[model samples]
Target: MFKKLKDGVNSLKKKVEEKTGIKEEEIRPEEIPETQETDEKPIDKDSDVKDKKTSFKNKAKKFIKERKVILSEDDVEDPISDFKFDLIENDVAFDVAEKIGEDVKKDLVGQEIKWREDVGKIVNESLRNSILNIFTSEFEFNRYIKETDKPVVIIFVGTNGVGKTTTIAKMAKMLRDKDYKTVLANGDTFRAGAMEQIEKHGEKLDLKVIKHQEGSDPAAVIYDAVEFAQANNYDIVLGDTAGRMHTDVNLMDQIKKIKRVVDPNLVFFVDEAVAGSDAVERAREFDEAVDIDASILTKIDADVSGGAAISISYATKNPIIFVGTGQSYDDLRKFDPEWFVEEIVG
Candidate 1:
């Protein structure tokens, strides 16, 4: 999915080596010998010769300890620029790309590189740490759900066609599989067939669905679901709201109303991984409007660039808790930052 970013990193490695004449492999301390053999004297029993050898060993040790490879500003300038362009071309937000470039420069410029160290590996590690820094909140989704109190209310929000409804169903199935009594609330009464779609999933999963007629107030449906969960002892309530673009002020306001009425424990913003930077912008806007607790990216398996997955959490300052991998009830997978970095950089 991150083919472009990976290629760009490889290019950066080559450029660094080309510009600095530095080999990719690092030199180890043990590789340096303590002394060199001399043809002048083979004094096997001479104490003076032994003392000379010891002195030579100490000098060599000191030299090796003091030696370090440092990259100058000019050494990294061109490579960082090229890599920044590469990130932007791959749909990374300009600000994010710039931040990565600056971070790489900070880590590499004037930093010591072992003589036999893999320069590429060092750069890659720096990039990985920089990217990981962008993730502010991370948690195990299943554990969080299980640990929360009974009838935990989770509201799903996103733009149209990001697979919000289907993702909700997948989440419901996930909870149900864990033996949590779940109920689906179709708060998306403004959208045609939204109720029917969620109801169909409910039937398939043998889970109950709470809904109201189309055009009815969305908040009322959620309120009913919450009350029902309280009364009937359901373990979780997965509420689905109507999909709307960030530009739709009215629909955004409706989401705000739902948030007010439901007081959900968690609010997830659903998006498509293929949406790239657009998804990041939408996440920002939605978060501004409703303060989303986390994100759920859909169609990740189909996204080639993987920019959205990389940038959304960073841009919105929210963690991505789950990802929709395919078109199945069990396709939703928990997000792992380390696994994602490995997939992109390994």
Candidate 2:
């Protein structure tokens, strides 16, 4: 995954080396002394070592004085422009791409490149820090739920065909494996097989499922599930909602009503990582309507550009809690900013 983004970063490294005319070996001050010949007549070994150290220090000072430490704006203009274009072409939002470019430029330009500091390394660190800044909110999902009150209500919301139901099942299994008594609430009564799908998953996991008949009020189903959880002392209540388009006013209003009735502890917006820019916009729309607590991106293993994962959290100002990597219940992995940056830039 993210092959294009990784390749772009590699290209940027080359650009940094080319523009600065500074090789990795040239940046190391220690390597210079090895090339110098030993004195023909060494009076004392300790004195010779001291003299060599002094000579190396003087050479380092002179090298530092002669080399340009600060990069000019014009020197990095072309590389930054190319990077921004690559991000946009890889499905990053336009504003997000611009912000990334601006951040890289701000950190790179006029910065002192010290001894043993490669320009490529500096550029990579600048980009990493800029991307890390976007992930302001980070939390451990399992730990948070464990600490929260019993019968923690969580609602899953997203547009159609984003694997909302399947993601909910995966989460239920995860909580169950953690020894939390979980219950699945089939609140997606508007969909044809939503109840059965969740029910089957519940049966496999040996967890109870709360539901109403088809065409029943979704909020009532959640309310009953919450009530059951409270009565039974269940650890979590995972509610599955019907997939509805964000632009549909009537369906969006239904979700708002569900929120009021259940007052869930967390509302997770599900999306497909492969959906690219469309997923980012949809998440924004849902967040504007009902204010999601976090997000879950499915099909992450299949996504190549990985722009949706990079852009959605920053755009929505919400952290991505987990990403679905495969079809198994254990495929869900918590989002880690450091891991993501390393994968893209290493």
Best by lDDT: 2
- Alpha-carbon runs more than 4 Å astray in model 2: 24-69, 114-117
Clashes of each: 6, 0
- Worst ten-residue run, lDDT, model 1? 34-43
lDDT of 2 by residue, 1-346 (tens): 8888888888887887666655543446555555444333344657978665555444454455565456789768999899998888888899888998999999988987755567778889999998888888886787889799888999999999898888988898888888999889999999898878888998888989999999999999999999999999998999999999999999999999999999999999999999999999999999998899999999989988878887998888999989999988889998998988998877
lDDT of 2: 0.86
- Where model 1 places Cα greater than 4 Å from the true spot, the runs are 24-68
Residue 76 in model 1: shift from native, Å?
1.1
RMSD of each: 9.1, 8.6
Give the least accurate 10-residue stretch of model 2, judged by summed lDDT: 34-43
lDDT of 1 by residue, 112-203 (tens): 76555677898888888987777758867778876889889999999998999999889888878889999999999987888789989999
Q: What is the C-alpha lDDT of each candidate?
A: 0.84, 0.86
